[model samples]
Target chain A: MPDPVGAVARLQQELTRLPGVGPKSAERIAHFLLSGDRKTAVALADALRDVVARVRPCRECFNLTEGELCPICSDSRRDAGSICVVETPRDIALFERAGSFRGLYHVLGGRLAPLDGVGPDQLTLAALAQRVRRGGVREVILATSPTLEGDGTALYASNLLDGTGVTITKLARGLPSGSSLELANPQMLVDAMDGRRTL
Target chain B: MPDPVGAVARLQQELTRLPGVGPKSAERIAHFLLSGDRKTAVALADALRDVVARVRPCRECFNLTEGELCPICSDSRRDAGSICVVETPRDIALFERAGSFRGLYHVLGGRLAPLDGVGPDQLTLAALAQRVRRGGVREVILATSPTLEGDGTALYASNLLDGTGVTITKLARGLPSGSSLELANPQMLVDAMDGRRTL
Candidate 1:
């Protein structure tokens, strides 16, 4: 028999639109929400609505935040003279979890992908340049991923800040920790050899 | 830096409670919602709330439905005399998808799993017995899965409907279609041999 109530189907349909969720996963999630406590589903719904209404990009750095400025931008203790540039706000969370980087961050919104029609205009490159040109900043670290597009984005950003006098740098690349040398790809091996430093 | 917006954290926390969603997956989903269109998030919330407020078990067969009776139970075209018994409302959907068995269904809520503290009382077995004893039902097909708990639940249900003058049957046990003979376990091979029929 057809599902008499359309709500379950609607919920499943909406769930499939998420990043990696598919039809099977959507069905499982829908069933879980329906079978469990009503509050769980309602709470999730409320949270989604609440976040969508309140969350927006930080005015200064474009990182996601509810207030006018992101937590890093508002914090008095973090080094305002140094900035770390990333492709998205999610990357900032990774750096934060590591508890390293004591500087500010600039979310580029996205990387430079010409094939996908993304260009410098699509990212926050102009804002990053303006912040650096305004002065006081001593360094601008390019922390984008080491993929082809990521490298292109970092190169493009570096050129954009050419005359700003900010010391530009990109993240170091090599074999990841806990990985065996036997499993390292040729490019990783090349990077490890090229980037080897004194112990 | 700490997330200034608590909504994102709350959403990720609640999403982790889902069956297969973990912290990483939840974070991805939360970010997706926060960055995407506001309507998508609101639509999901509405669907979830609508489902929780409306859907309930069919009073007769215990299958999930918005009305007093499920679609199969209310339809006159369905064979009421032949009731197919299953473990959950989801099983009814599987049978419906196959487009076979023009009969009503009885959802037992759950199967007998003594180790997990589930018993006949925890299921809808009492209601099932009541339905069989009410007369007019000619056959009760136990269509539970071929697992240990499923088989045990079927056996217990069969015994409960004894002396009701209704014919008791069960779904066939064998290797599934499109499966290799080499991959079939010893028990499945034995079952296939014992239940063989001449073409």
Candidate 2:
């Protein structure tokens, strides 16, 4: 590619490091930065610097935060006696967006992937167990995604919490609310069949 | 949504401002940056800042360069007498990659679009005309894209240079080497027919 303006090219390169961006997209973005108003570029640059400098993981839930505790963990109105476990903070956001859950959360950092050398020890499993042992927790919801790794992580967590007096529950499965058979995937079919309710 | 690390969230927001990036992709990138080594982020940021600080448009060709003239404009081997006019600097790079042309270039910056209020005066058409009028030039190639606006710009340019004695030519067209005829658009069909040569 023809070398663009130094700053434009530099910004484009940084932007291209993002997933799904190619050289053409990078060039388009660079051109936009060069031709766009000064305020936009400055805002973008400042945002980049600020994100790197200010954001941190919450001490209690591992959710993103600007302070020691995330907003969810600090909220007194949430159900502290029931914790929902997830593999990432994004998952917590998904749940929050659904607006159905009012419980506390625990981010596991990642799921167990033996091929990648990730195990229970590498995750927040021990912390979760400690939290469970400290007691009064009525239920532990396994809300990990339905992927293979997610399922494995949920099963492992369930095993870890066994005999701890806290009831374990997984999210419901069936035909998705508005979908027909024609639109469902193979896994969705199996899950729907496996989770069928009796009259 | 739960706020991620402040730095990470800020970076994600900045990244999403680029064309084609959405929130999910931005989040993926932010996570990648956080998971990556510090050097990578620093290098990316430095590159962005440096590019902005140093790069500028070449005075004569409008191609990107660290100095007033791009490498193509300064190269002794390039044909100073011929200029290839393109809609963008990215086109200059594409032509250079083809490596068949030995002429220098002039970027019009963009094609004319009345709806968007872009017109002849907004482009580098006058500069191109001036270059053609300066005497030794023998040919000017109209390599604008095959779009309605691109054609309009080309015709406008041809009319502007009507008395200049310079030979104007457009790039050739046919079924692109690896592309299928079924996939060819109407404009491509028109160009292919118009550009046909005796077998």
Candidate 3:
């Protein structure tokens, strides 16, 4: 049959490309957008564009930001002597929401997933090593997810910083296995932060 | 504490505004976008913008289209003598997907819901009535959803077309209650079409 509603069909297809959105959900969203006020549709489009245009990885920490450095990196009040490593910027946001971490963050962009072709070179591992070697950094916290890939990435980073004299710590096991920091409850996250163990 | 990853947090907030996207799903989508390729993000943004810029309701059928008239209204092969009335463009798509309806369509934009302040004025009933009176319309099918609002809208439209001399019919009752034509299985929809009843 002729796809007369081709524009709508295309919209649904594009929406389903996003994670967790299936064909049914995409269709529902397309209908909702078409039925809503024109301004709402326009605003969502603009937000999508703005996010891509204004946001970039922080040069130092890889967290998303509008400027050369992420806000956390530029903030003078944050502890300059400590860095918490994470897999993505969303993890940084989760930690920030709990209001417990006052140190700097280093986003690895992704964990070490050799199966997915992600290696130490693909991540910001060199920048992290350089930061550790530059001195005054008392600790490097491995706050990556507890997944196998996260554990592997942590081990790789720890090995690289073995003789650098900087203390290496990993977040505690209070967080359940296979759980993302992004999905962890605030209390559990706080417990994990408080009970961090030295590597 | 300060939201260090404010950009991601804001992006998630914006995503949750879309229909059927709850907070958890929204977060998942945001993380996906953050981790996804720039081209995918750009494509989604472009699609949203394109839909907003190009799609508008057809003047005659009220079906969404990129021009003054929808493809169904403009197509010469369609049976102009028969008009299938539906509550939304999504419903029109469902009917079209069946590939059996050679008739043109009229989208009511929504069903009658007094509690939601939706009335006959909010619908395309007047336009449909005008179309029915203008000429060669042998039949006007009330294919609105089977819900209370849908039945109310169908009844209201039937009353308006009372003296128009065109035959009035409704899709059969094989469709389950409190469900949408968009969600009906193809066989059930075909059965409803094959077993239509005249009023």
Candidate 4:
């Protein structure tokens, strides 16, 4: 419902479109923006605009980056031969927080989910094959979620890189079998990344 | 700590300033913004900036407004002789959503809280008294929260309007004694407004 005021209602509507924000939370957030620090609200708005306008997917790995490549891909010290593949840029942040995976990362943009019309062409499989074909990659670790879609994507990616000398691996079932990688705690992520096995 | 990338971390930091967003939720929101619907995030950012820039305090009643006065203050159909006093703009929205009130409102900006260093000087009490002294207002309803700060503000406002020939009323403690007017459900708010008692 539109709030008593048009702006409040509009704001509540905008917030409800977020990933996890519901109607009640949207109301609270809208009221807070209207009532709390104007500077804070302005800052958040500016940040929101800036992040979307400025941050782009890295050219090589497709992770969020202000430059041509993401920070991890640009860092010279990270193990260049080992590419830890994840489903999204946020997964990279999760890994970084866990203090695990010193190697580089490749973001698939998303996994295979035909129900949602997400297929092989919808992902970054071609880019993965190209990167592996370029050589020097000793191991390709699949850190996608352990869900059905994630497994299908991993199997598909493995078939694409089958001829390449790279040893393909998947994160151990250390994560709860079907839980999301994004929801894993830092310790759990650390353990999962450490115990990855050849696929 | 700032994330490895400047824009990602900046967005996360900005989100953390919101009322209920913690560090983890900030991270989640920031990442979701980057990866979710680009149009939705853009709209929210625009709304945030628009809300702060456009919604100003109503000139006569000190409630939030997109123009010179709030809807209630501008409407000719409302009961001009009854001004429901409130602690914030959100309370006015809450009451309006209840659809039980057809009177005007006077926002106090905030309730009196001495420990929080908020006093009469910090509120809109002077403007309220001036409004009452200008005459024609038959009932001045106090719809502040039911907390100590709310009661204290109600008492102070009552003292200010003691001899104005206006009947001042407080929303009966129809809400849970410790609940806030802004957080009250529409049904509860309707009941409270209906069961107001003479102060």
Which scores better on TM-score, 2 or 3? 2
* Residue-wise C-alpha lDDT for candidate 1, range A88-187, written one tens digit per residue: 8888888998888999999998899999999999999999999999998999999998999999999999999998888999999999999899999999
| Model 3 regions lying over 4 Å from their true place | A1-6, A174-199, B1-10, B174-199
User: What DockQ does each listed candidate score?
Assistant: 0.58, 0.41, 0.44, 0.51
- Cα-based lDDT at residue A14, candidate 2: 73
Q: Give the TM-score of candidate 3.
A: 0.83
Best by DockQ: 1
Candidate 2's displacement at residue B110, Å, is: 1.4
TM-score of chain B of each: 0.93, 0.92, 0.84, 0.84
Sorted by TM-score (best first), the order is: 1, 2, 4, 3
lDDT string, candidate 1, B1-78, tens digits? 455357778888998988789988987777777764567788888888888888888999988888898778888999
Residue-by-residue lDDT tens digits, candidate 4, A168-195:
9998766877789899988778778988
Compared with the true structure, what per-residue lDDT tens digits does model 3 show for residues B151-171? 888999999999989999998
Model 1 error, position B161 (Å): 1.2
Cα displacement (Å) at residue A49, model 1: 1.8
What are the clashing pairs of model 2?
A6-B51, A6-B52, A6-B55, A7-B51, A7-B52, A51-B7, A52-B7, A55-B5, A55-B6, A55-B7
- Residue by residue across B62-144, what tens digits does model 4's lDDT show? 88778898777888998999999998877787788778888899999898888888889889999999999999999999988
**Of 1 and 2, which scores higher on lDDT?**
1
In model 4 chain B, the worst 10-residue window by lDDT is: B1-10
Model 3 docking category: acceptable
- Model 2 chain A scores worst on lDDT over the 10 consecutive residues at A33-42
Local distance difference test values of all predictions, in order:
0.87, 0.80, 0.84, 0.85
